[model samples]
Target: MSRPDLFKGIVSVAGGIMLPIDQTLLPLKEKAILIYHGSNDDVIEISKSIQDYNKLKNIGTKNMELKIVKNANHFLSSQTFKDEYLYEWLEKNI
Candidate 1:
């Protein structure tokens, strides 16, 4: 599928400080990347996306949060949504 089509169902079900990494700038180098900090609007957008996805999938929000990483695309690039940062955020929020 096309790149955009592949991420059509993407969503973010939690909120927190996002240290989104820049994958396009990876391998050949590394950098500390962050985006959408303290942005309630962005967080809400993410939450809506998640909610829409869940509804489409016939799922319920038994346990969900409202937040997201910008420029990370779906799959949340390794550089953009690194495990360490994600876990830390999840630990604090969830």
Candidate 2:
């Protein structure tokens, strides 16, 4: 089956998906960037988030954090809509 093209518009947007990481996140280095991804996520691979974290870290972002929910799916099955990690991040950042 062919992949439904979801990236066409993404390419048009500067700092959108599949674009250069530095271009996308460099401007937000001063901001606290908290990324959340499920380790067992099938919709979006966890490596993508890790790669983003690594790139941001390499760029000297000190307030960045990546929380990988173990054995969780895309929506983090068995967890509340606002999970603990999210709550903690919000409390710290906000």
Candidate 3:
């Protein structure tokens, strides 16, 4: 999808696929923060995070099912989050 198709407005589109883990309200709240960024540096950090996610996902079974959302940034905040498309995709795949 085009970059424009990713966002609902100005925000990233990947936000919807998240499982609502909030890191800001952590430890006490037992939340997992979804880190979001808009720069190249952030992109690199996010890529590393995704790699880490893949690693974790690989531990349970010999065959791993991995889905990488297209055009999504580190926080999974693509423009696509504005609609239910990403959610539907995740529901179907994950």
Highest TM-score against the true fold, candidate: 2
Worst 10-residue lDDT window for candidate 2 reads: 7-16
Task: Give the Å error, residue 75, model 1.
Answer: 5.0
Compute each candidate's TM-score over C-alphas. Answer: 0.26, 0.67, 0.30
Off by over 4 Å in 3: 1-44, 61-78, 90-94
lDDT, residue 17, model 1 = 20
Over 1-94, each residue of candidate 3 has an lDDT whose tens digit, in order, gives: 2233332222122222233323321221221222233233343544554554444344432222233455555555444365475465445533
As a whole number from 0 to 100, the lDDT of residue 44 in candidate 1 is 44
User: What TM-score does candidate 3 reach?
Assistant: 0.30
lDDT per model, in order? 0.35, 0.58, 0.36
Q: Write the per-residue lDDT of candidate 1 for residues 1-94, one digit (tens) a residue.
A: 1133222122233333233223431221111112222223432445545444344234322333334555543344454354476566555543
**Predicted candidate 2 versus true structure: per-residue lDDT over 1-94, tens digit per residue:** 0332322111010011355755554555566766667777777778777777777678787887676767777776445345676566667765
Error of 1 at 59 (Å): 5.5
Global lDDT for candidate 1? 0.35
lDDT of 3 at 63: 23
CA lDDT, candidate 2, residue 93: 69
